[model samples]
Target chain A: MAALALPILALGALTACGAEEETGTPASDTTRTLKVGYISGTSLGPAFVADALGCYRDEGLTIEFEPIKNPADAIAFLATDKLDAYVGSPSAGMFNQVAKGAELKMVASLGSVNTPEGEAAPSGLFGAKSIKSVEELKGKRVALLGSVGSATSYLLGKSLEAGGLSFGDVELVTLGSSDMVPALKNGGVEAALLFAPETQKAIDQDVAHALVDSKKAYGSSTTAGIIFGTKLLKTERATGVSFLKANACAAKRFEGDWRKDAEIVKMLADFMKVPENTISGGGLYAFDSSLAINEGTLTEMQEMFVKVEGILTYTDLLPADKLVDDTLRAEAVGAA
Target chain B: MSPVTRDQEAVESTGTWRTIAPGPAELDPRGYARRRTLMERGLAILVPVALISLWQLLAGAGVLESNYFPPPSDIAASWADLLASGVYQESVLASLSRIVSGYLLGTSCAVALGMVIGSVRLLRVALEPTISALYTVPKLAILPLLLLIFGLGETSKILLVALTCFFVVLINTIDAVSSVSPRYHDVGRSCGASRWSTLVHITLPAALPQTLTGMRIASGLAVIVIVGAEFVAADAGLGFLVWNSWNLGVPEHMYVGIVSISLIGVIVGLVLRGVEWLLTPWNR
Candidate 1:
């Protein structure tokens, strides 16, 4: 009896130790905190805003943001339930995950690149100084953030096709988004398709020239960013909706007066690790924060993905119904 | 004095032993054979089989989560998928070709340089200290510099493998040659053998075993270094498969890559053993 009592005491102590290590709180609590994962990319903006504004707390969510180094990692975390929600591009990777029977769904549109007042957004295709025109880029090397199946690669291909050049006419190298700028500067690549601030920085350095503004060629009607996860929408639907509401509010605050809200811009710039002047000069577009996942845009994206099945096949890329749930977005927008 | 007395004594001893142990006759050859077979089988096969069975059971029961520790069945299925898709074969061929090319080139150069230095005391004094100092530094620490200079391409990877192979082979060659007895040299001189002939026949053969051991060691190092090189900025190879799978969040595929790497190591070890057996059969 004494020996048994000793083991029971040790077991109790061990159980307490395990609980403390796991929750870092008293073991008596029944609730588990929400774990949100995000990459240090554009997706971080909304999460940062939500945390800073206490919007998650307002919705009664204890949120923890896990930093991811890549979009693929974020998607993987979501698939494994390690993360409650993540934002990523609607590429073959997302489709592949869904096809593998991962219980996940795309919930809302976070941001988009579109023209304001029917004017083309200022996007650029930069190349080395030696290249004079898009014609000169033919048979030359160009770099994209991923392989041919990636969203950036699709956009680049579409832009090149618009310029009367085929993807086969150029060598497409796979470089990460962060590496693209340096790769261009070092002459490792003949050209690169980059987003706003990096594009502006490249032009300022005079190491690369703008070949074309992609928005003018591809049109403003495209889905650029999305919020996705399954468990978060299922269990913490209100908190998820509140997150979108907070994003919409922050977007309005950021867009209402870009000149007066210098602090907001500085915060974003600091997080993105770009110079304030560069961010200011880049002229980032103000996206509609309605939380709506535009079906027409997604349908168009699906068609584009199907058309480029040679690089990656997503013949059954989810239809509009499976891709999004607009009821939450509508409710969040109405509440806001 | 003795035949009849000896027979009588043997009979008396047998009767005394039988009185002490009164049971069925012990069959010496059968019992010995049975024990030998059991010991040999237990030591050679049963232990490994038991360990593998335990592993499979743990994996099957999902004691460790599937994502983190996939079952052996899953690894086998993945292996089959890769093989059928031709990816596994191509990657294995590519890695093996690179290792063989780099190992041969590096080992040859090391052997030549080491022989020259070992022959001359002045050269040995000049080179050995520098070589030893450089050898003490981990080879991986210099990889970033190698990448900067060579770019993250085939050349840089192969160069690193070769560099690792060179150090091992060079050190072993020097030691082997330096350890040759002075008696052999004296005998050769007495036999009127020229320096070149003596080295070719006596010294080279004497050093072959150690040189082979160095090659074996470098061969393993080549595999490790090549895998590491492939981890950064690679589009294909077993290492790239592991890296891409990890990034893509396919931990199952990562385990598949790991198992493939282990299989490659086993095959290389077996091949080196065969070579050793063929070259130095007299040792057996």
Candidate 2:
């Protein structure tokens, strides 16, 4: 009886292992659907436009958009193998996921904002209106749209230090950009660092003012929006690159003639549930058609991320070249 | 005469052979007590020890991916961190206070309304169908509507708990009160007792056990619903803790929160059982 049972158990184990291995491998079929999860924040506009334009379908890829409540949830879903890609705020939280052996790689760059002359985008100590000047914001509450360890939060901390304000002097509050407007209006916070449309809303509402644009603060030609993933990039590189190319096209179209792209603007307005005039007047940031991830900007971002958030401890920071893969992006842009 | 005597003798011998055999010494009072004590002590230690050992072994072997399933050690560390930081305590206390307030209010209202409806056939006929229909619908399906109305504050969370608990207690109270025998009421009437007196002395005691059982069920349901209520738009609470950990992609912390919830459930179950035992000693 024991001898008979041993063989049976072994057979069962073998079958289970074989089954898992077979299913675990990525499907070889090029026509496989890619399910992308994204937060319904303004960051998702380009991706939505790309989807709307049938870019993914044109490349023989089926795209499905799953709305996540927050960036953290989006990242979690991506890490758990529930999503092929997640588009949300660039955060050190993503770094935490990467540290856990998830094979995620930043793929393509997206939208970036330019600062209006004489005013910086609202962010840290320098951005606080209560300070009257950068010197007065020496010890005040500053809010970031994400967590303490997030990318924006770290960048804000660096920006404050550069402007002669130490991070220790300012208290950091983690709040969403949508919540930040009301929070600032209520004086629950002194200033909040946020990205566009929300930043524009803040300025329009007169609840808060822009401190400094990220590009101005960093004083570098940084890529604000970038696509990141691994499995999808590897298996569906052409489709992924085409998706970015479509977004670039949309961006160019939006920048070239805002009036002509009224439909796109209207769609964005409907999704945001704000007035069309408000959206149009928001001075929305646009991305360039270049699919390349600027090496210089990434280096600065990595350094800032490490110094402030300790996202990658000194030993964990990989070489800059390995952080980005632009071959597919190049191919797609070349075809265009 | 000789054949009759032989048959009688065989019958007598068979009757003697069929006498009861002696039982084991442990069946006696002293031995039995000792055996029971030993069994109780063994049970007291064995289950927890076995569970902990298994958990530790599985965790150490990386059987369930530490980030996702976290080992006992990691959970313990997190628990310690929470306790030391005072965040866990504060959230637990806040949630407990809300749950208790909602539960008490719900139970009191349910009992009063149930008694009134159960006593009056007209009211019962009018209300039972509506209440039953409402009960058939899932309690969670109305959460969005509640949030819209209440704006994701304490009132909404408490209301959800109350809503779920109220129906359970109401249904149970109705069943308990209505199940009273007609004979008891008849006897009370024959004794020239007042309606109130009859209800207080005879009907109430008979229904108390079932009513208490209902309260017990409602209490457990309150805990479950309260957790769900806290999940959405909550800044603090065990449910919020689970949600936060899930969002942060710390699956182990999520599991820890879940396990803590189960512990709370078990504790609540034990309390309910104790209450049942106290109210219905006859069940013992």
Candidate 3:
């Protein structure tokens, strides 16, 4: 008798769920929890600021930050609707996914290397003191955070290009950013493309010196940005806009050397579990308050990756429209 | 009926009745053995084929996402592509080179040291505990130090494989040598055998089976350790192939690397079994 009742109950529950789907009712904003993937550190400055300042709560959303070791994992999760949003660099992985018809997009630029004309960009190629120029890198090992398909690899190629060399000329070593400075010091690699505080560490330790500023090589460029998955892109776009609004609200705080702000520094330091000095000492990554996507830079990145054989599945470039949706960012910025 | 009656008469003569089943050898032994071997081979092939068919079905029906969980056919295509491109061949050769070099180096050193330590009481008492403690430490944990010491090259990865295989083979070799039968040693001594002669004829032969067993286990460990080390530290190898493909958002390529590694493991296991058979005749 109980077993018979159980099937009937289950049928009734499933019917109720089906009816809810049939009605096509929208979910409440307050009830929404956005799962955002992130790689920890200053790249996610705005998200951290947004979380700390309760911007997400104010916008009636709970932001669940999931730490990811690689952007590719986030891309996979995003395509499957496991992650609603992610903050990471634009990589060959993202482009390859788009080529494969995954419905994920770079909705907003998180940060860019917008260094002043005279100053060296904090993110660039740093090499051993004895070998001063990119030409010296010929036949020498140069490390990057990822392989030939990595975004940093593009930067390395550009730096190499300036010296009239190509990736084929040098041995490419894959090392984490933390390992870069040490590798340079210990001669594991002759040079490495390092980002801040690592770049700072290299200079301070007298191990390696900046050889090429990324700004001079590529001009003002978006290094990392926010991505939206199918769930946010098609199903619950309002929540996506709300997420961007919270992020944009926090981006206002990132204006003009945000590292100087004591509260921001403290919040970020606590969130990243690092000393306050580390936050203040590192070079600033610029975040646009409007949450704009640099279509030009995205084009450049795609072109660069497409040129490299076997890095991307498809050779043809994906138009900017397919890779990004500007409506969510526009809505978020308009609301602000 | 006639066989039952005859068996009953035999049982009555013996004053007891017992039912005994005939062994496979008694019931057409050659055919039985052939059937068993055929069944084993059939199941081995059938299970994986069934799994892959199920996977392809699910992927086709959209139960599994094609991008992340690519169909087996797609994986095969990607594997072929990699092969044609020379990436798969390069990766396999790299990993094989590391595994072979490290496995040979580690086992040779371990066996020599283990024999010496096992023979001398002072060395055994002084060193066994320390070696045991070191063995308990995770071999991969020292990879960072190896990288620091040896730099990020083939040396660190090769050494990591060696280190992992070393401990496993060392402990087993020590145990095998130390546990050789006392009667065998006495036989050699009573025959007026020299120390070297006893070691060669009596102790080594006694320990060879266990030592080979250790080597067999170390071969698998060598493959595992090298793959793991390659994931972090290498630009080429099966492990790197999997990692780089994933990084490149080519899941099919990643699957190819994974399948290749698994195939290598199976092949290595069979080769080791052959080695054990050749080395230990008495065990057979």
DockQ of 2: 0.12
Question: How do the residues B171-218 of candidate 3 rate in per-residue lDDT, one tens digit apiece?
Answer: 888899999989999999999999999999988989988988888899
Better of 1 and 2 by lDDT: 1
List, residue by residue over A1-336, the lDDT tens digit for candidate 1. 999999989987785566455435455653346776665544225545555556556554567767666666777778677887765565555555665555566666654455455543445577888887777888887877655545566678667866788667887666656667777877778888877667777778888887876666666544444455775566556556656665566555544324246666576667667676655555455456665566665555556556642332246667666656677677778877
Would you list the C-alpha lDDT of every candidate in the order shown?
0.67, 0.65, 0.84
**Residue range A226-291, candidate 2, lDDT tens digits:** 445665566545456656666565555555334337787777777556787765655544455664
Clashing pairs in 3: none
lDDT of 3 at B96: 99
Error of 3 at A289 (Å): 0.2
**Tens-digit lDDT track of model 1 for B101-211:** 778888889999888777777988899999998777777777766755775456766777788899899999998888888788889999999989989977887777887
| Best of the two (1, 3) by DockQ | 3
Query: Residue B7 deviation, candidate 1, in Å?
Result: 32
List residue ranges in candidate 2 displaced over 4 A.
A1-33, A51-54, A57-64, A67-70, A91-93, A109-227, A232-243, A256-259, A262-285, A291-336, B1-65, B133-153
- Listed in order, each prediction's TM-score against the native is 0.74, 0.67, 0.92
lDDT-superior candidate, 1 or 3: 3
For model 2, residues B10-36, the per-residue Cα lDDT tens digits are 567676333333444524978878888
RMSD (CA, angstroms), candidate 3: 7.8
For model 3, state the Cα shift of residue B237 in Å: 0.5
For candidate 3, write residues A257-307 as lDDT tens digits.
Answer: 788899999999988788999888887777779978888777887777776
